[model samples]
Target chain A: MNLKAIWWKLFCVLLLIYVAIAGLLSPVPRLNILNETIRNLYFHVPMWFGQIIIFTVSLVYSILYLLDTNQKNASSIANSKRDIAAHSAVTIGMLYGTLGLLTGMIWGNFTWGTPWSSDPKLNCTAIGMLIYLAYFVLRSSFTDIDKRARFAAIYNVFCYVMFVVLIFVIPRMREFSIHPGNGGNPGFATYDLDSAMRLVFYPAVIGWSLLAVWIWTILVKYREIKLFWNMRMNNPLSAVALDQV
Target chain B: MQAIITLIKKEATIEWRNRSVLGSLLLYTVLTVFLIFFSFRNLDPLSWATLFWIVMIFSSVDAIAKSFMQESQERWFYYYTLFTPGQLILAKLAYNLVLMVLVSTFTLLLFSLFVGFPIHDIGFFALALLGGVVCLTVLFTFMSVIAAKAGKNTALVTILSLPIAIPLLAVIINFTKKTLVVQNAVIYSTDIVLLCSINLLMIIMGYILFQFTWKE
Candidate 1:
């Protein structure tokens, strides 16, 4: 790949390496309770940021797929491409969300004295994850590629709207949350002590988000290549046109 | 408007002709409430509220699971020619709302008779129940359409809708619990606002998206 095409990928790698080194060895506030564990902010919180970015990408592609289908000049191949892109983004978003949950559990174990609690944030996250899991189940039940892609895109849009509502409503309804900045607890932002943490924290979020998008693009390309190869194996002549795509 | 009303009436006539489905659902509610009654002769308000919502969720799922699959393909084609997808979905949603309202009323009556009636604020209870019913019916109606298209049974419908319904369920359950167990706790308008907005969102989404699912 040329430098222009791979510049963001290079940026993601370099930034992540810096984060890994500085996140651990960099000077942090010496607090009474969260002396060392505060470094989790660098790793754990960025997963959610990355997940949200990828999930938004998935939602946009799903919407595009629907809008494209409604057009009179819609092509089958382009429609399928949008569907594949949306699915790949969701699959990667799920990975980021799972990592966030795992990292959160470990942090909660040390600080909250339990891996899981009745905290609204925790429950809402779990429910959001389940919604996407059901999306996969819904997709797998279909055998026809066109039907699966169309219905999955429709379901994707539906669930994303509901999930956004859930995230918006749940935290406001409850008066208490063990998570920071909700209810009465101090937010992680306050613990920055100085501008030192924000320097690492903001880059960590951006780097992880870019890394997620990069993986999603790779997955989309892989699927397209596989589709092309299968087409070539079936009919040698038809394969020439798909090469342009 | 007229088409939606006619479609709703058609649905009611079909449901009326097949009374066994409604009967079985009522029986299921009774059996569930009785099982809970026998297991715990006396219960506190918290358990009462918890078990009540549990029954509400399951029974609603059972009742609305058949909304789309009960019709034949030929009948759907016939209806498709006569009415637009928006009209068809609106009618189904309205009919399911009525059916769920009846089922929930019966369930609530059974709970009051079997377990002690813990809810003192009838107005608040009714408001919460209405929100819950609207949320469940709109959501399940759309989901049953998807499940039927997949050519699967009620299990697929349950798996698909239940997870997405959790947040609405959580809000309703929390509101009901407040009405039942807490004293001097005012009814929170924000909760009602949240429920109303969620219901509106789902109904609008279902109306717009049903056309995509209805396509053959």
Candidate 2:
């Protein structure tokens, strides 16, 4: 790993430490129903932000894989880089999305009287997970390696369109979305998460997203090395791959 | 242009020749809606609206899943050179849209016959039906091509489609809920806009991605 990436990982760790301590202990606005649970704003929302950013990175890689399928003097690393980035980003992104959903459910149970409230945002995230799960199912169904990646990339792009609609359009269109934002009412921007909360919330989002990217980079590097090692394994007497490790 | 027209014509002729398939699908739709009515007995307007949509969603999925299945291997190879991927998908989409419109309208009729009409806004209700069914057909057709190309497994087809399709289902159900407000002919601008936007997004995605899919 590069020194720069290590520094980023260190920064993410430090920032998350600050978020965990401050997020729980900080003085939050004591609104009637929400009361203490407003602290979840710093933790839960960042998971979603991180998930979306990671998924976007995954989608970018998939697009690159598709566009570069027919191009020039592509090194072996560059060729497989697309699959590595897309696969790892999706793995980490789904992790964040699942964690976000669980935390949101817990927070909802405290504030909204029920964990499984029919909030449009909650439903969208749930469906988003299902869509990605289907993407995995699509991947496993294919026996050919290159073919699987091609189809997965295509599905990834198409499904993201639906994902965009779920989060952005549907919640805004509905009139009772329960998300404090956009259900015929002004969204999270105009209300909810007062300035006091934004202090932790913004940093929490950045830290979590940076952590996700760091994990993703590690995954990519590991895969790249594995590819290099496999190439070296063509000659059994070679210890060259071990030197890189 | 001619390619698209010819493909649509071919799709229609084949569908006509295979009348029993369409007949059986219609029979299945009738039975499904009827069984639902018998089980529920009588639903409130909202419940009825939701039930009607549930039936249409499943039936549309079943119907559109067949869009890419009818071609023989040799026919597919022959047509591969005859049409661009865009032209092929456009024709399939157009044909499926027509099929969904007819089937959905028939479904609405059967729903009224069996389940009783709960709709207050006939105008908005039809708009929702048209928009919703078109959305269903577009999505499942796009997914159908992908599923068809992947492995042609029926169960896998539903698994392939359910995630992306459910969000559209949720939006349509919510839109239908608006229509059941006990008011006369109420259609909100916002709901209409949202439904249209979802449909537009699906159509554009289908157009863009089908080329990659059909290349397989």
Candidate 3:
């Protein structure tokens, strides 16, 4: 990795370590129905925040892909690099979304009496996840790499628009949603989250998002490495090493 | 504007030429409604509304997929020279929207023939039906284009359309179900506006994005 990436990795690691120790050891407001599980706010909510930012990054890359005119030439600046950046952001963003959902389900089971509720918030997020899953399916059906990038980027833009509708717009319109502020009586039953929780909560969001960006860059680099592997696939010297790895 | 009209006329002539495809689609709709009718012989109002949406969803998928997939790539190559991607997509959207509206209306009639229409405000229900049809048409048309470009993979039609459809469907379903459960009640106009805005957003995106996919 380069100097900037090294700095990012250093910051991500340091921040996450701080979040874990300080977050776990921090004093939390004791309340019924979520006495100790309240700490999950630091863990579960950050995944969602990280997911939204990562997807927004993916959306930016997709727009860049669309704005590019050099898409015709494979080796050009608009070709594989931007395409891979868009793809990497999408895949890692999907991973973060899935993690967010799974964590929410566990937290719900503990606090809400069931792992799955018909809550609009949960349902909409599920829909959002499906939108991205469809993204991957759209990607797999293409055989030409360049066309794959173009079509998938178009679909990515469309998916992000719909995802915003489902995740953010729709939930706020209804009053019955279980999510805080929009539904269920404003911000976790009107008892404001304690100041200490906000301290870890804000940093966890930053730390987790940095980790996502770090992973996203790794995937971007791996795309180039994989391209190299594909180029060298027929070489006898590389065959044994590839097989062993 | 001229390009879109001529392309649409071309699409119409092609659609009319393929009578068997239309016949099979009607058959598929009838069979699906009949199956739902047999399974739930007497459905409650909510169930009836849900069933109607389900039947219409499948038929719209079939109808729109046929519009995109029926054209062989050789034909697409011809059209590529003849019209721009924006014109081609807009024409296809227009044709499929008209086709789905007809199909959904017929499905509603056939579906109610078996299950019965428990909807109180037929006017708003029809409005919701039209809005739902627009959503389905715009979405499946966009998705079918993506699927068609990916080498005419038909299975990708449903896989790609559902996630996008489900959220929009939730709004429509809730709106439709409200009419079913409470007679002559007004659903929040905000929802209707949101739905319309979704349709508007989709067409705008289609207009902007089809150019990139149009590249050879």
Candidate 4:
């Protein structure tokens, strides 16, 4: 690997180490009863944070793709960059979404007295996850590359808006939840989270984000290779076509 | 203005020509309303109103998806209408709004006849219905466009529409509760304003984004 790749790997390693040490050893003294259970927050919240970051990256790439398509002198480099960014975002977003659901389920089991509830927040999140899952389903259903990408990009934009409404707006509007500041249930403020918790939480967010980016980079490279193979398969006479051009 | 009028007229004409589609939508709406009224026979006025909103929203989805999905099957006509995606969206929104209003009113009327609940404030109820219809139409119009290109149009439309529809659902239910249970006009006035804001936002966003979505 190149120097930049090596540096990223080192950065990720250090982040993982920091999260491991901080999450285990840190004394969240403010959370008197919950104790070690509060540590799950470090992992759970970061997964959502990382998912939002990846989704934002995906949206940026989609806007770029739309603009690039309209341009007469679009650079291959720009197209490649947009492709890499988009593929990376989707891959990372999927991972974060899966991890978030898993961690949230565990957290829910302990805090809410059940693994799942009909709370609006939980329902909306389940719906959001299913929507993204449908996004991949829509992508796989199409055999045409150009059509798949275009359709997926449009769907991504639509889902992102829904994500905003469901995750952010809807939960805040209704007062029916065990989550923080929703209904009668006590939340983070009730816990009086210690400074020590903050120490782990911030780093966990950073670590998860870095790991997502690292995984995204690898996935983008893999996608590029797959696309390359597909193109070569489709255009057996590409060499002749290139010679004529 | 003329373009918009023509587009609206064209959409109405197209919809009229497809009598089966319109027939199915109307039949579905009527059946849903009847089922809800039958199932919730013992429900209080508040619960009845809640069920009514649910039926209306789902039925609106059935009607609006038809209009949006027709664009994909008639690609040439859709492209020809591209001289005005905003006007086309508005026209679609207007048509769907009218359809939703008719369906909601008919369902509510049948609900009153069957369930025998007194509507305390007819004026507030009318305002709530207007707000709810506008919200549903604007929201579903955008959803219809998104679902138009989806692999399974029916499933995708439902998935994509539900999340956005929740806010509208929440507002409508709250308004229904206020009107039917508490008989409070003041509570629903705020909700009606919020619903109107949502309608305005959906329209502006739809106007801006429909171009991106509608491009061939």
Winning candidate number (TM-score):
1
Q: Per-residue CA lDDT of candidate 2, range A29-135, in tens?
A: 66677788878888888998999999999999998887776454333346566877898889899999889989988998887889897776777777889889898
TM-score of each: 0.94, 0.86, 0.91, 0.87
Predicted complex 1: DockQ: 0.67
Once superposed on the true structure, which residue ranges of model 1 sit more than 4 Å away at CA? A1-4, A73-75, A171-174, A232-240, B181-186
List interface RMSDs for the candidates, in order.
Answer: 1.4, 1.7, 1.9, 3.1
| lDDT by residue (tens digit), candidate 1, B5-33 | 99889889988999999899999999999
lDDT of 4 by residue, B1-216 (tens): 777778778887897888888788778877776776677667677677777788787888887877767765577465565666777777778778877887777777777777766667777778888888887888777767766766437766776667567655876777766665446455565676666766676677677667666555
Clashing pairs in 3: A181-A187
Residue B88's lDDT within candidate 2 is: 89
Per-residue error (Å), model 2, residue A161:
1.9
- TM-score of model 3 vs. true structure: 0.91
Q: Which 10-residue span in candidate 4 chain A carries the lowest summed lDDT?
A: A236-245
Please provide, for model 1 over A27-105, each residue's C-alpha lDDT reduced to its tens digit, 9 standing for 90 to 100. 9988766779899999999999999999999999999988877665444777778988999999999999999999999
Candidate 4: which stretches are off by over 4 Å? A1-5, A30-33, A72-84, A141-143, A165-167, A170-176, A180-194, A239-245, B72-78, B181-185
Full-model lDDT for every candidate: 0.85, 0.80, 0.80, 0.71
Report the lDDT tens digits of candidate 3 across residue range B84-126. Answer: 7878888899988888878987898897688788887777778
Which of the CAPRI classes, incorrect, acceptable, medium or high, describes model 4?
Answer: acceptable
TM-score of chain B of each: 0.95, 0.94, 0.94, 0.89
Q: Name the runs in model 2 displaced over 4 angstroms.
A: A1-4, A24-38, A70-77, A171-199, A224-245, B177-188
